[model samples]
Target: MPKTKTERVTISLCPPVDLGGEPGWIPFDAPSLVGESLRFVSGEPDGNRFRARYYRDAEQHLHARIWFGPETEGPPGHAHGGAVAAVMDEALGLAAWAAGYPIVVGNLNVSFRNMLPLQKVVTVESRVISAEGRKVMVHGRIFSGETVYAEAECLCITIPGK
Candidate 1:
């Protein structure tokens, strides 16, 4: 038998800021509230797919600092629209949950503003805008500074009896 050489690959990741240390922001574990069902988009905190962390501000507004890895790329050097939508879906629904409404996303409408570049950490800010009966409306945007990548409106329906 002949001996073979092994190869190693190293990947550099750019994590988001430490929101837990930032004033007026409190970090949270999404899985604790929503269970492991949300692990798809936020499953791997330091993974090659997507890295996400959740926080709540002084006003109790849910915010997420997310990084889209190379595995999420669609158009050369950018993230896929589906990837963007997945983030919106998870973040918005989680927003409703954080607001004390146990719900599931009934409908989601996302408008693509600009193509998101991969490997960069972006902020997803979400808030429950209105709640009428079982309907909960959440508005959120994915942006980095002045660049708005996408905006989404999620209609969540409260789980029966929850």
Candidate 2:
């Protein structure tokens, strides 16, 4: 009998709070697509492959403590580029929302500086760079201490109604 190879992967994450002590880190509440608060990614019951807790720093920037789990792996032990982009998309878009713009991302540009390791915690920081007419520009980075993993710029457009 031959052993079967499995393509299915299981993801696991350590709580962000256990990684570091975040000051003034408050839970950000955003309307969920399912009419509840945002939960797992792609509606996966196990958990979000990349779990992020949003916050507002003392300087009023949109900040997030994110964990990349095994489910997000792209290369061996590194997280997939799409996973990083997804985190940036949500974080940058949320930045626009936190700035009082009811918005949806029009375009999202991401630059991968380095491969992010799986099962590690990183901080995602975002700021609304500018707002002109319906376009809102947001910049963000994913980093752990001094190492930068990725950076992103998101163009957001205001929704018709809140």
Candidate 3:
């Protein structure tokens, strides 16, 4: 028996299905969109204390875990506000992708609230709240061991070419 060109596949449904009744259709020979599979293929940086790990939750919200070490320290043993902002920005980018929106930061607005401690395992979380066409609104927070160091709100746009 020979396997036909036709294939059987599974697709995830979105809040509102746009591509017919299916959300994502996997073909026998190729991938339509670069989704979770792409994330795993291109994992986050490693071998550094100040590394960020990216993950996607069951609800499809983007999540990241990071650590800031001595190299990234400022003010003698404390993390810099700019460092905190960078972490938040990464999370925001992942959030856009998880929400079926792949985007580039158009305008990022970050607000600092407190100090972040260096050499501690900091965490960042983000998600997409709203979107229109290629434009999306992303929000995220940076935390130092349960204490919030900063928050962010970004206006981003998805470049359709991936």
- Judged by TM-score, which candidate is best? 1
Better of 1 and 2 by TM-score: 1
Q: Tell me how far the alpha carbon of residue 23 in candidate 2 is from the true structure, in angstroms, after superposition.
A: 2.2
Q: Tens digit of lDDT per residue, candidate 2, span 1-162? A: 876886778645444434343867665654442133244442332354766566777777878778887788899999999989988887888888888888888999999999999888899999999999999999999999999999999999998867
What's the alpha carbon RMSD for model 2?
4.3
Query: What shift in Å separates residue 73 of candidate 2 from its native position after superposition?
Result: 0.8
TM-score for each predicted model, relative to the true structure: 0.88, 0.80, 0.67
Which lDDT values do the candidates have, in the order given? Answer: 0.91, 0.79, 0.63
- What lDDT score goes with residue 14 in model 2? 45
In the range 22-102, model 3's lDDT, one tens digit per residue, is 122221110123444433212323422255555555666665556665556777888776666666665676677667776
Please list the residue runs of candidate 1 whose C-alpha ends up more than 4 Å from where it truly belongs after superposition: 1-22
Q: Model 3: runs farther than 4 Å from truth?
A: 1-49, 144-146
- In angstroms, the error of model 1 at 105 is 0.6
Better of 2 and 3 by TM-score: 2
User: For residues 25-70, what per-residue lDDT tens digits would candidate 1 score against the true structure?
Assistant: 7897789999988989988777778888899999999998888989
- For residue 77, give model 3's deviation from the true position in Å: 0.8
Q: Which stretches of candidate 2 lie over 4 Å from their true place?
A: 1-21, 31-48
- Top model by lDDT, which number? 1
